[model samples]
Target: MTYTRSEFPDTFLFGLSASDPGDEALTEGFDSFRFPVHWQQVLPRGRGEPDSGGLDHYKHLIDTVLRRGLRPCAILDSSTLPDAIADLGGWRNRDSANWFAHFAETVIEHIGDRLFSAGPAARSWTVGKSDHLGTDLRAHARSLHHHLLATGHAIRAMRSYGMTNLGVEFQLDEPEANTALHAYFHGEYTKDYLAKFSPNLPKNWQRDFDSIDEPIDWCALNYAHFKDLDGSLPWSSLHREDTGETPLYVVADLGSVENTENLLGDIRSDLAQGAPIKGLFAQAQEGECLGLLQTALSGGKQPAPWVAPTKALHGHWNMVADVGGTNTRLGVVTNGHLDELHKFPTGSLEDFQAALRRVRDAVGTDPQAVVAAGAGPLRDGVIQLTNASLTLSRDTLASSTGAQRTFVINDFTAAAWSVADIKAKDVAVLQGSGSPPPGTRLVVGPGTGLGVGALLYSEGHYHTVSGEGGHMGLSPRHRDEVDVFDAARRIAPECFFADSLAIEAEMFLSGTGLPILYQAVCMAGGQSDTPTLSAKDILQAAQSGADEFAVKTARMFTEHLGAITGDLAVALIPVGGVFLLGGVADKNRWLFGQEFLDAFNAGGRFDDIRGGLNLYVSEMDEFGIVGANNFCKNALAR
Candidate 1:
């Protein structure tokens, strides 16, 4: 059967390796091109400043690819080290890693935005033919080890420059011959290098390797020749599954028309047998081979860019739910206005599906779309509540509510989305002057658990990014705080999940954390006979000034909250505003006074930036619901 490109998955990328940008016809039928950028050519000396002429040449080539509506995959050639660096022992030179990292950073800063994918260097650095290095096994091992190290450094540098979609290239050989060699190669690149050759590796090399987290996002396999198809296909599939790396298969060295057809046939057979191939590429060094591969790939079209799925609301009747740890708030949006709001204890329901069913019954109308924000980590369209024994999923929400589409987002993400609709009356300002400018906004609060999310504005639309900022390690500032923190570490060891005496922000900032903080305060004051008080009791006592321990606990909690919020604000630079939400903040607005403001604006060098930030305590109890409604409207409009 003659196979067509239509048979492959829509997201599967098909492209070729090209050096000449002037040859526009070379990329006519391809969606991507693998452009090899030689380090020796760009940096010549492999140190100091990069050559402007060489940099512009590659930049122009990348620009041409983008101009022609094709994605460019750049591969930095590590094999061709600059003459100066090679003289100093090339990859074997320990300092060469830093030089390569610098080069990677420079290249990424210049053209990272335009490229679809990038690699620190060609894959041959790790798995190339080892015969060229002679009989010195230690030298050969060190060279290979340093290459991997340099690649790791380069990957980190590229990521720092905001380059995502990074990858690595590997050459695939015969299955039997590859199995053992590939294992050794993979082990060295991953976590097992030090175990195998600790003596040969550089001092403290394990620490450096440990710092790298799953360096590459994808792997490009160079498929040249495989005699045993049955043996090779399964091995390749197993390798991809084991490494958890997306595989992009490239048929290397296309010679004749017959050879190209045979390779294509092999690819078709692999696809038919369920090979996990995410992309396909053809390597044609010569003009004739390029023409042959192009003709063979005729009728193939570039896949459209992937966009997150959203359901358009047919009318104004949309359902929104804020699934908090203690209570669940459900509301209906009519013509962009929220109405028919209902509240119920979250613990009373079995799961989110039952809650959705109750809302549907109360409203007597099926929602066009449903957006449920939960207080937990969202994974695979589901959330397992951190404080409550409840689970929510998009499928369950859709089935129960009879909505065309459903969204499961973090509770803080919902709060961040609400920032666009916040009014002057609903906000109580604590810092800065007038209204905040249009940029990034941060919404963080302490409730059952500390929630953190950011709203980023780009292309005239707001995008929400959620994070587990509450788990960040908290440090004491003064002597009193240090004493309380140390006491808490001894009294409540369960709250410290990390190293000894390491207290997480949520361990003292959330509603659940308040009771622990109060107990710690009593212990620090050498009063161990005090009764264990609930978070509510402590808050009431503190508000009435009846208990000094409770007041101290409240004060410590707000101070830590300010410090953590300030740290996050500095890191995120939420220029729009820093919003404080959740029940604890709403109920205890008086606690967030001068001390909280002082703590927030306490950055040593960044004091001016922190002081200039607009801080607001959101009094709106339906902030999450309103945010959900806004999110639903925006999604539907999109």
Candidate 2:
């Protein structure tokens, strides 16, 4: 697994935002690994000893990585760990030598033997310390020197354990990289001007200026990378680009460097021109980071000083995997942020792979890091190897008239595949994140049809059973007009409730349901002559409390929606919140807000049945995207 000079043309060294060596490399097939060890974990709270947390577990994890052929680097994180926060009274201050040295000694004494390098993933001061009051600018950046020395010393000490490399990861980790607040960092020109106005400026400003002390000596960060996780953050962030008119993403452009792919080439050029080290470290979001890095590495292009991790997975700190209906899409969410997207549409085998190719090419991505593209639902029924079986399937279809044309998938199983974890916080739904019972969660979206998913919590994990539970027959509330029953009968004439007897809750409660209710109202109220409008139009009028018949329809739709949600809740009682998603949930907030809650919570004697359950709206249309990214990141992590 050793990276040869030619393997990385510029001796690129890739690693993680977090993770120790063996755990890092072995997981994602990286030659090297990096895991940040919180200093708080290394040093105890209130000036005590650090918690070992059974170093053997870590040792074993690393050993696992090493056995899998990967190099691992350990990072000593002093700032963000909870212990550090707790010790600092909810603030990351105390950049003291004793703390640094003590933590360094701890690492050297612990698993130093297995480490490829001891890293200090440097922090770019937090907003609190800079804006408020803590340390002056001089003291802020100077704080790094103490920690840097400690890091260097630890590397020296850990090397005694048969170690070979030591590295520094100087980060401008501020997602607000390009904010105007950073204008002070430019130099004395702004410094004098600012001092003249404020006299005693905020400690936060001073703290921020601390890191700007010296150009991070290139010689020290011999193997470094600039992590710009989001490009649109800069290009379209704050509308600061040359085009001042375009809407801006809150995460401004200066905070990140995603606008230019050549940004990497520039960093390499700087390193070669005696700028610094020879690697580039960029952020690939939670799941896509290492995958994209690997993609870059595996490509025919000559690699730079950027070092790739031997292993990669969605960091446990914040990871989510969302499987799509029909197994066609997957999304990865990290700490609730949807970051990566992978999708495979159910199509002709050949056409599917071709579409996948189109998707990859459109993203300007390479296919080397792709493990496999799978098909089928989680219930274990249908699976078509759309990627692998494409050519043969196409030929078969062309030659044999009996050949199946389109791939059929069990959308429920696909939904379950994404929700297969032992536990989770929020299940994707129409009403964002809802709080349910202490087990798995269930959401039933009844659109044109029903969409059923069960969130199962087991052995400290959350699993969702996405199934076609929508087609179930609806109960006739009050001898529905035989007319409606007759129409339903025409659509589905079989089974106990079909053909005039069965009414699906979906047609009565989902995105397509409201209109039916409205249509029924119009016909019953003698306004059947009114122009036909889509479900969306009815809700729009309902939202404004207009269109009398629309109001009645909205109320009825809300009632049915609540009834179905109640049924699902009673069945799952999900401890994690129930999230309502899709077109109906997003737009019909008025209905859910007013009458739906009233209906669901209005149990004559069983109010307690629905009392504890929480409801939410899934705002991001990219739930599937996040699910896809989560799947990729988690699969890679595993």
Per-residue lDDT for 367 in model 2? 23
**What is the number of residue pairs that collide in model 1?**
0
Deviation in Å, model 2, residue 312 alpha carbon: 16
Top-lDDT structure, candidate number: 1
lDDT string for model 2 (1-638, tens) is 21223434444554343344433334342344445676655555524565667455567666765665555556666555434434453222434434454556566556765565564544444322223224455433334333333444444333323334554443333321232223312322244434543444324445433332222212112112234453212222222332133211111112232332344444444334443233433332344444445565554434222233332212211112222323445333334444556666545645444544554434332221222223232223234442233232223322222111212223333333333331325433333334333556555444434566665778765544555566566654445444444443433355325334567666666665556656766665665476677888888887788798787667667776676677677667765655555557655566666567766665656677676676655455444443433344444433
Q: Could you give candidate 1's per-residue lDDT for residues 1-638 as a string of tens digits?
A: 34457767777777877666576444576777777887877888888788998899998887677776677888877666777887787767777777887788777766666778888543423222222555555555566656656776677667644467887665555222233234323443434544554577566655555323335677666555533333223435555544444555564656555555666676667666666567666663556656665664575665763221222112326789998877888887877888789888888345556777887766654676899988888898889988788888888787797675789888888888988766767788888745555878898888777888898878667887888888888877777777788888986776676665668888888888888888888988999786888888999999899999999988888788998899999998987889999888888888899999999999999999999899998877688898888888888775
Consecutive 10-residue window with the lowest summed lDDT within model 1? 306-315
The CA root-mean-square deviation of candidate 1, after full C-alpha superposition on the true structure, stands at 15.4
Clashes of 2: 98
Judging by TM-score against the true structure, name the best candidate.
1
Name every residue pair that clashes in candidate 1: none
